[model samples]
Target: EAGVAQSPRYKIIEKRQSVAFWCNPISGHATLYWYQQILGQGPKLLIQFQNNGVVDDSQLPKDRFSAERLKGVDSTLKIQPAKLEDSAVYLCASSPRDSANYGYTFGSGTRLTVV
Candidate 1:
């Protein structure tokens, strides 16, 4: 199966700068997820979407982070005024609506470093 696609595999930004990452899910996937992975820790779900609507975003830092899945195919995640603590890998994943049976396909992720 084809994997999800993410751009700018690495990024380095000064503190308080802004950055954005883009993702293209596998064809036919209806569910999408964005995750943040800090060093030595498991990935944390930042946002989730089913089709074009948001399913959950409780973990997303609204004050500094935002995401959208327009048309339910492509997605983007952005962080503004980034902090050192936000330096982590931003991962994008996708799955079918009935994903529990098939599992999710993840992208290589964008590594952001806040100086």
Candidate 2:
């Protein structure tokens, strides 16, 4: 089975610009997640989706960030009108539903650098 895949793996954008990140989870996985990891900090859960329906998105910054899992397979994360502090790594993860310790697999991530 193919592991999670993300594009660019690195991004540099000016503040106030818009940027998006992509993710492809492992095949047959039923749960997908998007996380934002700041430097020196553990990953924070931005959103969790069970298939295409949202399970939780409480931590997501709805103002400048948005995400989607249209087909419940591949996913995307976007940051609009980026900020200098928005520079961070965006990781995509997924796991099987049957296990509580689903053992999420993460993409290398899109490292956004805003200046």
Candidate with maximal TM-score: 1
Name the regions of candidate 1 deviating beyond 4 angstroms: none
Q: Which lDDT tens digits does candidate 2 get at residues 1-115? A: 7889999789999999999888889898999988889999999999998999898999988999898899888888889989998888888989988365758888788889999
lDDT for each residue of candidate 1 in 1-115, tens digit (9 for 90 to 100)? 6789999999999999999999999999999999999999999999999998999999999999999999989999999989999999999999987456878899999999999
The lDDT, on a scale of 0 to 1, for candidate 1 is 0.94
Q: Count the backbone clashes (under 3 Å) in each candidate.
A: 0, 0
The parts of candidate 2 lying over 4 Å away from their true place are none
RMSD, one per candidate, in order: 1.0, 1.1
